[model samples]
Each structure stands twice: as structure tokens, then as C-alpha cells.
Target: MYKAYVFVKRGFVSMLSYRMAFVLTLLGTFVGAAQFYFMAKFLGEGHEFPLLAPYGGNLMGYLIIGTTFMSFVGVSLNSFQGAIRGEQQMGTLEFLLMSDTPLHQILIYSALWNFLYACLSTSVIFLVVVFVLGMDINVNLGAALFILLLSVVCMSGFGLMSAGIIMVTKQGDPITWAFGTLSGLLSGAMFPVELLPPFLRTVAVALPPTHALIALRKTIMVRAGLGEVRSQVLALLALTALTLPIGLVVFRWGFNRARTDGSLAEY
Candidate 1:
């Protein structure tokens, strides 16, 4: 835990060095939300989209949840891989591996700052949607937080798998690219999963982010309790159970292979 804190602190200080970028990112968050807000209102008003029925036909609120959750999902999906790439580019990968820290700890902690930033970004989006856009939000804080944490764990598994691929090949990871692209298109990030065809819907159901977004939207927009989202929660738990171990094993193998090949210092 202390080690994680140190990583988070280091990340925070590093982020502070680029104050303009941080401010621009925050501004961009609002701009993105506003664009979606107007679009949802324009398309949803006086129109019946069965895909949005679960959200009470409030497209803005539905989109707000989707966008916010995807922000975190984006971080969890890319942070570890990006961290590994950054370390390699900076010539620190070998030194970190040579240290006394367990490789898994290093891998996980390295992305802690990204996750923290993601949480902040998600919060900002939610605030903008609720306050700036005057969207009504019913937040079940406890359940929403639980779903968020589970989603992070589930997505981190994918991130670690991607990181493993990076460790070995050093670049051009089709897995990460495909997963990010498909997840964004199919995970109900900016829209509902039901809008997809049956086959694609099935694929979306298998992705942890789909279930996580559904549960999160329910908890936030509908003020649902944990019991109400039990199925989504269970699905996410099952995904985490299956993927986390596999990701760890793959990452360890890749790391060891890179070390053995003396390519850890190579970008």
C-alpha cells in the first residue's frame, strides 16, 4: 500500500509539471460532455429508441454515465501498457526489474497514477453533466463505487495482458488495439449495447465493461442498490476471477522472457 502511495505521489508531482496540459484536459472533458449532451437531446427528444428504454429515455443521463465510466475503462485498459512503454522509452525498465520490488507490484503500481487521474476525470465529467448541463442524477454512492472498483479490476486484467505483449514485442500490440477499438464500439460506452446486432450483442455481453457500465448506470441514474445490480456484479466478479490470474501469468512470462533475452533495455 505504501509503495502504491509512493507511485501515486510521484505521478501526481509529474502531472503537476504539465499544468497547461492538465487544464486543457479538464476543459476538454467539459467540451466533450457538452457535445454529447446536445446530441442526445437532439436525437432523443420526441423519439423512441428502445435501446434507451432502460434509462427512462433520458439520453443525456444515459450518455453521461456511459462517458464517465468509459473514461475509467480507458485508463484501466491502457495504463499498464502505457506505463510499460514509457519505462522502456525512458530506459528505466531494466533498473526497475533489477530492484528488490516484485515485478508484479512494479507493474501494478506503475499504473496507479493513471487510475487516480481517471477517477478524477470521471468525477469531473459527472459533475459537469449534473451541474453544468442541469441533468438530474440519482447517485447510489456505495453501489456506484463498488461497481467502479470491480470494473477497474476487470479492465486491469486486460491492461496487464496488453502490457505483457508490450514487454515481449516492444511495439505493435494487436490485442490492445483490437480490445480498445471493439470495447469502445460495443461496450455501451457512448450508446446502448442493444443497438448492436444479436451476434455483436453477445460479444458485448462477454466483455466486462459492458456489464460494468450497465450496473454503474443503474446505480447512478436509477439509484439502484447492490442487490438490484447483483447479476452485473456477479458477471464482473466472474470475469475478474478468470482474467486476473491469466493476465498475471502472461505478464510474468513476458517479463521473464524479455529479461532472458536482454531486451528489457530495448525500445
Candidate 2:
């Protein structure tokens, strides 16, 4: 816990050190939300798309929730890989590996600050949409949080896998790319999955984010209880069960291979 706090403190200080960048990032959050707002307005207020029936048919709110929730998902998916990449680039990876801390723990701790910042950014988006844009949300905070927790765990499995691959490849990873691109298009990030062709819809179901966005929207928009999203929750749990072990095994292999090849500091 103290180690996690140190990482968070370092991240906070690092972010504060770049005051202009930090401010711009916050500003960018609002800009992104506004862009969605206008796009939603362009579609006409209260315009009901047949596919968005489960989400109460509010496009703006749907987009806002999708983007906001996915920001956290992005953090979960990218932060570990980013941490590994950053350490390698900074020539600190070898030194960190030599320390008493385990590499996996280091990677996990390194992302704490990023997850915190993501929370702040998502908060800004939610505030703007709900308070300023007058979007309605009947959020069951507990259920929403539970779904998010599961989603993060599911995504982190992939993050660990990506981080491991980066340890060996020292280049862009395919796992992150696949999820970032495919999930954006197929996971109902900006639109409904129901709008997709039948085969595409089947493909979307295989992605964790597809289930996450669906459950999150239902929970936030319709105040669905945990039981109401049982299938999505179960799906996330199964994915987590399947992916996390593989991620750990892959990470172990990559970590050992990197150590044996003495490539930790090469990148």
C-alpha cells in the first residue's frame, strides 16, 4: 500500500510538473465531451434510435457514458504497457528489475497514478454531461462501480499480456492495438452493437468491452441492479478467469526471456 502511494505521489508530482499539459488535458476532456454533445444534438434531441432501446434512446448520454467509461478502460488496458515502455525508454527498467520489488508489482504500482488521473478526467466528462448538458442518469452507483471493477480486471489481463509482449518486442503491441481499434468499432463505443451485422455482432460479443458497455449503460441509464446484468457480469468473470492466467503466464515467459537475453535495458 505504501508502495502504491509512492507511485501515486510520483505521478501526481510528475503531472503537476507539467502544469500547462495538465491544464490542456483537462480542457481537452471538456472539448471531447462537447464534441459528442454537438454530435448528439445534430441527431436531434430525444431522437430514438431503435437499437438504443435498452439505454433509454438518448444518444448524448449514451455517448458520454461510453466515452467516459472507456477512458477508464483505456487506462486499464494501456497503463501497464505504458509503464513498461516508459521505464525501458528512460533506461530504468534494469535498475527496477534489480530492486527488491517484483516486476509485475512494479508494473501494477506504476499505473496507479494513471488510474487516478483517469478517474478525474472521467469525473469531468460526467459532470459536464449530467449537470451542464442536462443529460439524465439514474446511476446505481454500487452496481456501476462493480461492473467497472470487473471490466478493469478483465482489461488488465490484456494489459499484462501487452506489457509482456512489449518487454520482448520493444515496439507497438498487437494486443493493445486489436482491443483499442476493434473494441472502439465493435464494442458499441459510439453506437449500438445491434446496428452491426449478425456476424459482426457475434464478434462484438467476444470482446470484453462489448459486455462492459452494455452492462454499464444498463446500470447507469436504467438503474439496473446487479442481478439484471447477471449475464454480462458472468461473461466478464469468465473472461477474467480465462485471460488473467494466460496473461500471467505470458508475462512470466517474456520477463524471463528478457532477463536471459539481457534486453531489459536495450530499449
Candidate 3:
């Protein structure tokens, strides 16, 4: 935990050095939120979407929840791989690996800042949507938070798998790309998954993000309790169980292979 704190502090200091970039990022987030707010309004045409009935039939509320959750998904999908890639590019990965710290701990600590930043950005977006844009959303805060945590854990498993591939190949991570693309299209990030065809709907159901979004929308927009979102919660838990161990095994194997090949320092 102390080690993680040090890493987080280092990351925060580094980010603070780039004040302009930080400001620009915040500005970009606001713009993105505003664009989505208007788009949802236009799409809804002052009428509720039948597909969004579970989320209180409010288009803005539905999109806001989706957008906020998807931001976390993006962070969890890229954090580990981005950390590894950054270290390798900076010629620091080998030095870090030589330390007494476990490789997994190092990876997790490195990505901790990105996860924290993503959460902060999500909160900022949510506030802007609700206060500035006047989007009406009823939230069960505790349940929403729990669902978001589960979603992050599940997505981080896939991120670890991508990091494993990066360790070996050094680039060209098809897993991260494919998963990100598919999740955006099928995970109800922008629209309801119920609108998809039957086969695509089945595929959507199998993905963790789909269930996460469902649970989030229910809990946040519809003010549902944990018990009301029991199915989605169980689905996310099952995905976490299925993916996390496999991700760890694959990452360990890739790390060993990279070390054996003396390629950890290679770009």
C-alpha cells in the first residue's frame, strides 16, 4: 500500500508539471459531455425511449450514466498496457523489473494514477451533466459505486491480458483494440443493447461491460438497490472470476518469456 502511494504521488507530480495538458484534458471532457447531452436531447425528440424504460426513460440520464461508466471502462481497458508501454518507451522498465518489487505489484501501482484520474474525470463529467446541463438523475449512490467497482475489476482483467501481450510482442495488442471496439459497439455504452440483433445481443450479454452498464443504469438512473440488480451483479462477478486468474497466468508467462529473451528493455 505504501508502494502504491509512492507511485501515485510520483504520477501526480509528473502530471502537475504539464499544467496546459491537464487543463486541455479537462476542457475536452467538458466538451465531450456537452456534445453528448445535446445529442441525447436531439435523439429523444422530447419523448422517452421505450428501450430506456429501465433507466426511468430519460435519455440524458441514460447517456450520462453510460458515458460515465464507459470512461472507467476505457481506463481499466488501457491502464496496465499503457503503463508498461510508457515505461518501456522511457527506458525505465528494465530498471524497475530489477528491483525487489513483484512485477504484478509494479504494474498495478503504475496504473493506479490513471485509474484515479479516470475516476476524477468521471465525477467532473457527472457534475457538469447534472448541474450545468440540468439532467435529472436519481441515484442510489452506494449501489452505483459497488457496480462501478465491479466493472473496473472485470475490465482490469482484460487490461492485464493486454499487458501480457505487450510484454512479449512489445506492440500490436489486438486484444485491447478488439475488446475496446466491440465493447463500445455492443456494451450499451452509447445506446441500449436491446436494439441489437439476437446474435449480437447474445454476444453483448456475454461481455462484462454490458452487464455493468445495465446494473449502473438501474442503480443510478432508476434508483434500484443491489437486490434489484442481482442478476447483473452476479454476471459481473462471474466475469471477474473467469478472467482475472487467466489474465494473471498469461501476464506471468509473458513476463518470464520476455526476461528469458532479454527483451524487457527492448522497444
**Model 3, span 1-267: residue lDDT tens:** 899999999999998999999999999989988988999889888575788888888888777777777778888878888888889999998888889998888987887788899889988998988888898888999999899888898888898898889989998888898888899899998889988999999999878999999999888887899999999999999999999998898888888899899888776
Scored against the true structure, residue 236 in model 1 reaches a CA lDDT of 96
Task: Evaluate all candidate structures by whole-model CA lDDT and list the values in order.
Answer: 0.84, 0.87, 0.88
lDDT by residue (tens digit), candidate 1, 1-267 = 898998899899988999999999999988988998999889877888777666565788888777777777778878887888888888887788778898778877987788778888878787777877788778899999999988999888888888888889988787678778888899998888877999999999889889998888888878889999999999999999998998888888888889899887777
lDDT of 3 at 73: 80
In model 1, the runs with Cα more than 4 Å from the true position are none
lDDT of model 1 at position 175: 67
Over the stretch 139-257, how does candidate 2's per-residue lDDT look in tens digits? 89899989987898898989989888988998888998988888889999998888899999999998999999999999999899999999999999999999999889888888888
* Model 1 vs truth, CA RMSD: 1.5
- TM-score: model 3 vs. ground truth: 0.96
Q: What TM-score does candidate 1 reach?
A: 0.95
How far does residue 229 in candidate 2 sit from its true spot (Å)? Answer: 0.6
